[model samples]
Target: MRAPVAMKKVVISLFAILAGTSFALAADTGCDAFKWPVEREQALFPSAPAAQSGAALTVGEAVDFSLAAVDTISFEVPPGHAPAAGTFGATARVTVPPEGELQFSLSDDAWIDVVQDGKTVKSAAFSGVKNCPGIRKSLRFKLAGGAAIIQLSGAKKADLKVAVLTPE
Candidate 1:
């Protein structure tokens, strides 16, 4: 009788622990917590094809870029923040339409600067969350629409996945 009761208690404790773990996992993947829906970006991240650094980027395409040391790439405009030693960076070009609000999503934490006509385009808004599975940060820029350079710097990793999206 005593052995059976002890066994039952152990089973109940194990179930409770499993339940809590499941809940935590669910919360970590709650990517919808962003200000706007990120379903398109989220879906593209997993299978997006890789593109060379400095390649021309298309709107709504997620591309993985291989980064070099910060000192190696020649940025169209100086990076908004000076990259510290050991940081990685890269650059790419894109064309924006007039009166457009573009959202740039990144797979890892990094500093993003949009330069058009020799000036840095100011970001209209930004959002970031750690619990989101793939994307780590996003920035929305209001641009006059022309050729622009996307300067990515101060990243901790050597490779980054990025998507330039026109929000839905």
Candidate 2:
């Protein structure tokens, strides 16, 4: 059996090992700004769009916002997960503006796969991502004149929640 301190040490060691040289640094602005992108709140395609399932964050270029820092981002998935069924993923473009390197990170148990300028840049698997418990995930992107759709995926769509976009 491992003591609480030992368990924490193991987790921290794992995080430090994977995070490389910046595991202790927090986003300059905040942490509660990774909700839906600044776009129209609608389901994808004509097909239900998987609500209570996942959200498509449509981010526009030339737009920047601030966030309130948090501790973690929790993610929860269905009982059994499979690939062929596509474990709830999302899609988004970088929008028209052509800028710099867009950074993205995740909180809780959720994960994000980014498609920049019509190409896949990064993908991550966050653990224990649940309904808006905590969100410290951060990702930045360089504008490229178009739109970016950030599709989210996991076990249960309703189980995950990041900082939702301020209602417009």
Candidate 3:
């Protein structure tokens, strides 16, 4: 068991090195898409009083992901000051192009999930990124015409970007 785990890590690490892997919306999209809006929006954390809400974002809205952990990554709260379970959450919406794939890097010690039509498609564990502090790890998901919902749980106020790629 331990051997397999170690081997898997090596395989993933190599894959990252090889596939060093968004934006905008269509006229049919419900919301307006911007050029990866970083300046337009603000960061939310698990604390700060104001950042203490689990708002299920409306699809097609211009928003970024906020994790619930120590403020070590992009949009983060302080360490030891991490929020309790369910205090932090996030969502990223992506339009599936017939058949497409989504991939992104995230922190390792984070609880991330991918949901489609309320039904969870996949889930996994990530160990912080190599050489990248705070940022978890990388994840890849393949989907069809259905909607893609990337949810970030656990980390109480961190920053994570989303991208939909490899449309076919």
- Report the number of the highest-TM-score candidate: 1
User: Which tens-of-lDDT digit does each residue in 64-96 have in candidate 2?
Assistant: 111111112222322122222423333233333
Better of 2 and 3 by TM-score: 3
Clashing pairs in 1: none
Model 2 misplaced regions, further than 4 Å: 1-87, 91-107, 123-133, 155-157, 162-168
The TM-score of candidate 3 is: 0.41
The most accurate candidate by lDDT is: 1
lDDT of 3 at 111: 51
lDDT of each: 0.87, 0.36, 0.42
Model 3, global lDDT: 0.42
Ranking by lDDT: 1, 3, 2
Regions of candidate 3 where Cα sits further than 4 Å from its true position = 1-87, 107-109, 123-130, 161-168
How many residue pairs in model 3 have overlapping backbones?
A: 21
lDDT of 2: 0.36
User: Which residue runs of candidate 1 sit more than 4 Å off their true CA positions?
Assistant: 1-29
Model 2 weakest 10-residue run by lDDT: 61-70
Clashes of each: 0, 47, 21
**Per-candidate TM-score against the hidden true structure:** 0.81, 0.34, 0.41
Please provide, for model 3 over 1-168, each residue's C-alpha lDDT reduced to its tens digit, 9 standing for 90 to 100: 266888999999988766653122233132122212221122211111221224333322333354544222332222223435545555445665564555444433445566676566552322232333333354555656656655555553455443222311
